[model samples]
Target: YGGIFTPTEAAGVGVMAMLAIAITQGALNWTQLKDSLLQTADTSAMIFAIILGSEVFDAFLARSQLPMKAAEWVSATGLPPFGVMALLMLFYILLGAVMDELAMILLTLPVFFPIVAALDFGLPPEETAIWFGILVLIVVGIGLTCPPIGLNVFVVSAIARDVPITAIYRGVLPFVAADIMRLALVTAFPVIALLLVRLLD
Candidate 1:
């Protein structure tokens, strides 16, 4: 909250804090610690594999210039800014369904950011960027709860072994709907996204 730590540093601090609390609570036995370390290693390996795969996929897309061509086509259509934005949002949702959220952002931004920056969204350049980011984040979150490839659902399933995968997916449907509504609200009224940023400013 103080903004004194980078994300990686913050994660380290959080782990250390939790470790201290667990020790104080008499919950830091050697067996439990070994199990926790093993679990962490396993989880990290899975995440690393996913990230590596996404990186390879992103590289393939970049080499193919598919995103750039899509952007060029959209630009050629001369659609209204809102129409273009709608299409971009739809594309993001679809892409996010199969792609890692981080990779999705990095792969599309180079093409999409320039397209967005060129359009007049009735907001300052910085504000437009922020609003767009929030929207993408919401969409990515939706994708994360979507079925067949919802990474978050799978991750949760790993932790909650007794819960059926189908049940987990079912549980996330409401969240997906809510996120869609949020995306719509933010898209229709960009100021909703910008309000807090303005307050902070």
Candidate 2:
């Protein structure tokens, strides 16, 4: 039988194997590893900047009391479990149309999460939070590929200005449909998002 190792041990072993492979390929050198680490550091730094920027606005939203009011309104509605979920998805989708996904999640989740937790969704609060988060992410994904203001679509167009945005949108339509199907399944079942959480036990 094959034996397993701790993740740290496996990663150490993998790094050693990578060094051996690079040596075999005639590319192993202190300079090459240093360059790779520098590149990784640059990428990580860019990501950290965005996270920090979003957190700044996220903190403001919590301090304003608006999120708590929204949560209160949601709880007062007494909507059915599925209806409550649908409303949350729609709310996130419409918000995604104008707001950045990271900022919206960081800000709105604090408000909306309390509302969700108060409901009797036949699931634990933690599971409801995770499930709702997955739906919110799916909704924001549409904005990533949408035209007029899609950041990803704009990035693609900037690189190839000759190609019309229409073409890109058309090209991405099928993928959007696939995404919708994935969202529907996850929304309907909820288990898709919770499998790992369930499995860890």
Candidate 3:
């Protein structure tokens, strides 16, 4: 509830609140809380390790100079910066069929992030970065509801296997399209993401 705290501190408070609730409800006793803390520590360590590993990998890639070279190649194509971003998103959507979202993020962030960051979208660099991250998250959520590797589809499949997979995919297509439309707005207009802040301020 503190307005001045950074997001990292906010998240820490949120987790503490959840831990407090679990203890109150007896869902997390002393022994269970200890286990949860251990698990959280393990996961957090692995996440940072991945971040550091990815950083080193990004450095290696930069040293090779291929992405910059590729960006130069792309810049020569005369496409708008956001146009290039749209094309990149389509590629991510297609890739979602083959790879899970987190895998795609982990593997490609090192490569694509630098490329996107280098482009000018009239916004500051950090705003562009946040916009692109939201775009990737939206695309991944779409992928989860889609076919070939749809996590939601699989979850629903067992509940309604008699309902043909094709039929389910057909049914969900409109919802997915709606999601795409929403994300398209977010991609094209950054204000939607910041609307709450604008209103509050």
Candidate with maximal lDDT: 1
The TM-score between candidate 1 and the true structure equals 0.84
Residues 36-129, candidate 1, lDDT per residue (tens digit)? 9998888777767766776787788779987788888888988899989888887777777677788778878888988898999899999999
lDDT of 2 at 87: 74
**By summed lDDT, which 10 consecutive residues of candidate 3 come out lowest?**
49-58
Q: Which residue pairs of candidate 2 clash?
A: none
Write one digit per residue (lDDT tens) for candidate 3, span 70-139.
5466556778888888877776676555455666577667778887898888877767777788888988
lDDT of 2 by residue, 44-108 (tens): 56555544654665567668866566666767778897777777776665555444676777777
| TM-score of candidate 3 relative to the true fold | 0.59
In order of appearance, the predictions have TM-scores of 0.84, 0.61, 0.59
Better of 1 and 2 by TM-score: 1
CA RMSD for every model?
2.5, 6.3, 8.0
Best by TM-score: 1
Residue runs of model 2 more than 4 Å from their true location after superposition? 1-77
After aligning candidate 1 to the native by TM-score, how far in Å is the CA of 75 from where it should be? 2.2
Worst 10 residues of 2 by lDDT: 146-155
Full-model lDDT, candidate 1:
0.84
Q: How accurate is candidate 2 locally (lDDT)?
A: 0.71
